[model samples]
Target: MKLVQFWRNGRPALGLQTERGVVDAAAEATRLGVTVPEDMAAAIALPAGELERLLTPLLQDPQCFTGAPLAPVVTGTDRIFCIGLNYRQHAKECGLPIPPAPVLFNKFSNALAAHGDCVKLIPDYKKYDYEAELVSVIGKPARNVSEEDALDYVFGYTCGNDLSTRDLQFARGGQWVLSKTFDGFAPVGPCLVPAGELDPNHLDISSTVNGEVRQSSNTSDMIFPLAQIIADLSHHFTLMPGDLIFTGTPQGVMHGYPADQKSWLKPGDWVEVTIQGIGTLRTTFC
Candidate 1:
């Protein structure tokens, strides 16, 4: 089942994207006199198969919802962790050695942006770039889990663009957090697919600027897959439901290109990040 969050009655509400349409889970539950989780976070915490059981009735209904604006697929997450150079090709392009372990960074909740939202670019930064990524959403609390069993704790996966300002990122002794956590920098969604439904490490991921493709590669290129990332992270900090892990991006970022061939993103550019099985997430630069 595809899960989504949408604005209704001036607030974020849980939604289920089905063949019929995006159903307002809360509204449907109320109409049917059934109880259900209120939002994505609550839904994620539901016992195994419970969410599906509760929403099955709503999915069978014929009614379809339309005209509501989408919110970020996952919200109120305690931590937003990102992996750097997890893609071998990306690291090769940048001429950096592949890290021995997953390199971690972070973004705050303020960086979250929904599908179709317009992202405002900082006027002073001229090296804005897009990194198409596969995001793993944790479903349950996991601490000191082994790599073999890491994926069992995943709630689902979604498409994400790790929008960055190369100038800020590599300047002043490397201000990674400041460069990466800008408001609207992490645009994720379109919809979230339960982990059981898709293979996170084998999906095709790509990014397009305007109408042209920029990054095109598969998750198979990842140097450290999602399972390892989860296990590695769980060893240090407990992985909680709703916490997002951006598994890094493939090659083809503008920063990876030769100086003479580089073309940075600017105002009026529309960016889309697509991951196989999930969907495309669109963001406009203004």
Candidate 2:
């Protein structure tokens, strides 16, 4: 089943995507006198068995649903860990060598923006780029996890655009945090597919800007795949529920293009990233 969150009373509330429309799970639970998670964070933190039980009956009769405006998938996810240069071709495109281990970075909660939202670009800064990525949502606390069992801790998957400001990222002594953590820099969602429903390793992922394809590749191109990333990171620090992992982007970023062919994102440009099984995440720069 696909899950999402839509704004209710100016706050994020849990909802399920169905053929008809988005089912307000919290509202439906109230109508039926049943109890379930109240928000996206709680739903993702739920143990597998309990979450399944909670959804079983609701799937039978989805009433009082609406096509409400969406909120960021996890409004308050604890950590947003990001992988950098994890795709071999992407590394090559940037003229960097393959890394011996996973390269990690982070984005704070303030960067979270929802699908269909407008990302206001910082003025006088020109090199805004788009990165299409698959995000893994953590379901349970994990420490010292083995690669073989790493996926067991995953709750689901979502689409994300790791929007970057090239000048701040490269011109300021590698100011990755300052460059990428601008408010609304990370736009995610539209739908979050349960991990059991899709294979993360074999999916088609692509991104387009103003209807022109920029990045076109598959999850299969990731040099350090999801399981290895989790296992490696968990050994150093615990991975908690509501935490997110942004598996890196593929080649074709503007930074990778020849000098004459490169043009950064500008105001009024619409950016969209799509992953097979999961829905498209669309945002506009203003």
Candidate 3:
């Protein structure tokens, strides 16, 4: 179920990674002459169980499967809701107290890009940094949901890089929006794994800059875990399919280190965010 929206000959198309270098789901169906909607968003947005049926043919194809070509997971996501300092260890490293609830923040849709897309380093800020995080993809519209039922609305999980401009994130006089939500700042998706695949509470998340590991922690350290976050966030707005929730990063960020030792991200640096069950999300600043 590694769904992706790809461009073939300048046209937007949906594809799924198979053994044969990303079988063009829609096109393959057209060839077999079976017309089925294959757009990644449309398939996910379809009523509950319908998306699976659309992929049944491709799953059973005799060619056996391969992987996909380079393509962004989705062209657009409704919202990129992010949380700040939700990890206890991370909070301690930053010299901040753990909050009673999820410390929420947000990244705009413009920040959405594929795993390997280059993150554009704007001239506005000098301290570019990386925050490796686990991203949740909402499967259904949910509001005022109970913690027990919170995860039911989730379609899958993925890796995300919450790229930031530290100067604007903290040193700015205004909101965090200036520091977060910059274009190409949030790099998401190598694959979107179904919720049933992993225990959201105990999964491990880690990040590496170039070849050096910088951040390593498990979701177990999260002060506000998935259910609580879903409940809290849904209290204010309806969570819809394709919407993203960026769970906060763990400690070891450059900002957590002393000012003199902070080695912020620079152009030509490669970042890889990896979650235990979900695959790695790789990006470069250029």
Candidate 4:
């Protein structure tokens, strides 16, 4: 089921996308006096099969929602785990050798913006770059998970842009935090598709900047696939529901271009990150 959040009468509510029209889950539940999940987190945490069945009647109603509007699937994510150099091509583009393990990094929740939200270009950094990645959403508590079963803990997937400030990223000691976690840097969620719907190995993922394709590849090329990433990460800390893990980007970032030919993202530049079977996440720079 394609789940979303949309505004109904100026209040944020959950939606279940169906053939008739998007079902305003929260609205219908309230009208029926049925208990509605408190927030997106709770809604997702609810036993999906049972919850879906309970809401099926309302979900089939055409008048359950107002006009379809924008809403992020969930708000206030607890953690944003980002992987770096997990794609062999992306590693080579930066003139670096393939890593021995998944290169892990992080972005604060402050970096998250919904699809259609504007990413503010930090005026000082003219060399902004985009990295299209597959974002994994954790659905259950996980600690010390094995690579074999790690994927079982995942809830779904989404598309993300790991927007980077190249200068700050490479300058000084090359710490990625300041360069990559600028406010509104991560725009996700046209939809968060259930993992059951996709095969992580063969999906097509692409990134387009201002209508021009800049990055295109398949998950088959990932150096550290989802299961390994989950297992490795779990060895250190517990992976909780609502924590988003960006699996890493493919090659063709602007920073990978020849120095003389490089061009950074500017105001009004639009970016779309599309993962086959998942959904496209589009955002504009301000």
lDDT by residue (tens digit), candidate 4, 1-286: 6776675566557776666766777667788877766556876687746556766666554466645675666566859999999888888888999888888889988888777888889688788999998988898899999999998888888888899999899899996988889998887877777777787878899999889999999999999999999999999999998899989999999988998989789999999999998778999988
TM-score of 3: 0.91
lDDT of 3 by residue, 114-232 (tens): 86788889776789889999888888899999999998888878888888888887774755877888888888878677666778899989999998999999999999989999999
Off by over 4 Å in 4: 7-12, 18-21, 31-34
Of the candidates numbered 1 and 4, which has the greater TM-score value?
1
Q: Clashing residue pairs in candidate 3, if any?
A: 18-65, 18-66, 19-65, 19-66, 20-66
Candidate 3 regions exceeding 4 Å error are 9-12, 62-71
Give TM per candidate.
0.97, 0.97, 0.91, 0.92
Winner on lDDT between 1 and 3 is 1
lDDT of 2 by residue, 1-286 (tens): 8888999888888888888888989888888889988888888767677887897678787887967789998877648999999898999999999999999999999999999999999796899999999999988999999999999999999999999999889986888888988999989998888889999999999999999998889999999999999999999999998898999999998989999998899899999999999989999989
lDDT of 3 at 249: 92
Clashing pairs in 4: none
The Cα RMSD in angstroms, rounded to one decimal, for candidate 2 relative to the true structure is 1.2
Better of 1 and 3 by TM-score: 1
Model 1, backbone clash pairs (residues 3+ apart or across chains), number: 0
Report lDDT (CA) for all predictions.
0.91, 0.91, 0.80, 0.83
Query: Which candidate order results from sorting by lDDT in descending order?
Result: 1, 2, 4, 3
Worst lDDT window (10 residues) for model 3? 62-71
Candidate 2 clash pair list: none
